[model samples]
Target: MGSFHAMHIETRVTGFIEENCYLVSNPDTQEVVVIDPGDDAADLAARLRGQNFKVVAYLLTHGHVDHISALADLCADFPAPIHIHPADAAWCFTEQNAILGLYPAPRKPDCPLVDATEGMVFELAGASWTVLETPGHTPGCICWKLDAANALFAGDTLFRDSAGRTDLPGGNPRALTQSLRKLAALPDDLRVFSGHGELTTIGREKRENFFMQF
Candidate 1:
């Protein structure tokens, strides 16, 4: 077994709206990935210090304000490369200009944007995660698939009962519907780890998620 045999991948729901920030690490390697450090920078950093996990990279599921408020703070302390899809990258530093006008906290990005490409893979805890573009809630929204853990880190594109609103800038109702269709087709056994709210499974969503209904 690898160091991550019993790895502690904790998820903290921070910010006023309860955005999810995931800390994934491999104890053996002491390396970790921080996903969506939306708020409470000091608190998040403290948690990292306690775990002694060296943050290797910062992953943004989208550029929405609630999902990126603590980005600068995370970048400052970890100094890890920031990765995001190019579509919504410009909104990172300019909340006032966000198409949705819902950027809760605005801060500039420390490094240039990192493109989330198809087939692009990143390793964590000796396992791999594949990035899948699933736009609708945002033009650059992405879902990270951790097949080893049978988890899908879905951003605002998907939820438990309903789907993300396409009323915001760059949001397309038709596109969102199409994206939902794609997600609906995934294996029912895959665990659906959303950016907000409670955790669910693809099977549960398929059967009860009204938005994903065919």
Candidate 2:
């Protein structure tokens, strides 16, 4: 498929875990979408201070604390509605989950949280995106596929050479394996921007990622 326009992508590694927060924008139009604003709200805000981009929405790949630590802060600063899968939204606001024990306090998004369903389509940064239900890292883990840009925001599902750990709550090895298979079947040239670590291509992952073999 041909791209409608060129999209510029900037990755910000945030939080103690070094999670990646992606700023996707259409340079020509200055429309932007913020993905997984992990932490370091001050830094995030500073980065966008002089930017001419208009934030359309905030997209969450999953509800993991590390990936959402700065959700409330970012929303407070940008005032954009957040989109996340319903399954993970249930545990996202509470500190009852095992992973929440690691954090000092529970986080509640300051902005409205919208449920994102598989196959849902939305436009951002002048490109159309299709939501893919790729679970296993969490019950509601999702990947946003921007076919026009040939990019996928894969949140802790299928990483560079490894997959998200299944020992955490809601994690299922079998489900992860199935999810990997689903991702592996996508176009080889699709660029993968994962929750953590460097960006990778589907082709490289299919050939080198051990999880893809499953």
Candidate 3:
């Protein structure tokens, strides 16, 4: 749980993979930002309605099965544009993305798919949002930065004492290293909301995460 001024943030560990889904909402405005609705579409949807959240947008940190498996399902009920990097948008919901036993291919939502370009800005939950394109785990991987909270929504790119593996499809160790360098340059006080595991700070990762050091 976190707060962006009066807005509320709830983290739901969903699906078998335990991907973190973030619901950032401003109760006064009834507007919410849905980040990486990986799995458990039913529960995710229920939680939103239960809280009277009006989803303003669906932001994808990247287009991995564990990160976006529930996107299509959620979009069906909540009509909002989906924002993802063009690189990931190219092949995210195809049959090629299907995992043998872990996940099935995700369907393309009927709603709009906007290219979440680097440095693109947005206003949601009464906070300023910046899109940082960090391609490593996937070509279209991105980290959402919330200036109000000084938080980085790192989706499988940088983790606690670890970084996202580049051995997966479209993974690139070199690109990941470059991305980490970019994050390392940010303010040490910025809170890191990792895609998995416990939360950490940029300063802590710079000292403890070997990948960040490299």
Candidate 4:
């Protein structure tokens, strides 16, 4: 875990796919933002309870089940607001989102879901984050940008050495290309916290990641 911009950020790899669930908190106040609580709900919730931090919200990059499967269960314990792009929010919790012989549908949560729109600014604890719409892997794929931390929560939209796949339901190759163009334009110093895999910086990906090069 690293403390950047006066906040402590911890990543927990969960579930069979080893999805990354991030807990970002202010070191002093302990107010936290739970990003992409994918799976292993019980353990995640328990850890949160153990810390006793105030959960301000749950942020979803898109509504893919692997990235949001534990959202409902975690909300049951934390009861914080959820934020996801409207396009993805439409069917994320439905049976249509389930994977055959693998993951099941995520339960709709008691917490309300706030729309995560393009250019939206989230002022949390003491820092600000801007929402960058990067729809491709899913219709509502997004990346959360925290200028203070110089960090981007890339989710499935981006990864190390590659980017998100555009072969699933609602996938669009052209749209993803456009999204990559947008991300490629950003400064290279921002460190990327992807939905899966290890950490990487925008500079590194821009140089090594073929998708970012395009």
Estimate the TM-score of every prediction: 0.91, 0.94, 0.96, 0.96
Q: What RMSD does model 4 have?
A: 2.0
Number of clashing residue pairs in every model? 0, 0, 0, 0
Ranking by lDDT: 3, 4, 2, 1
Error of 3 at 33 (Å): 0.3
TM-score of 1: 0.91
Cand. 4 Cα-lDDT: 0.89
lDDT of each: 0.79, 0.85, 0.89, 0.89
Please give me the total number of clashing residue pairs in predicted model 4: 0
lDDT of 4 at 47: 84
Model 4 weakest 10-residue run by lDDT: 1-10
Output the lDDT of residue 214, model 3: 60
Q: Candidate 1 on 1-214: residue-level lDDT in tens?
A: 2332545567999977798888877777788878888888899989888878888878888888888888887777777877789888856567443434445446685755678866689775577878988888888888888776677888888888877889877889988888888888889998777889888888898899988788
**Candidate 1 structure lDDT:** 0.79
In candidate 2, what are the lDDT values of residues 73-124, reduced to their tens digit? 7777788878999999988777654353355444786788888999999876
Q: Is candidate 1 or candidate 3 better by TM-score?
A: 3
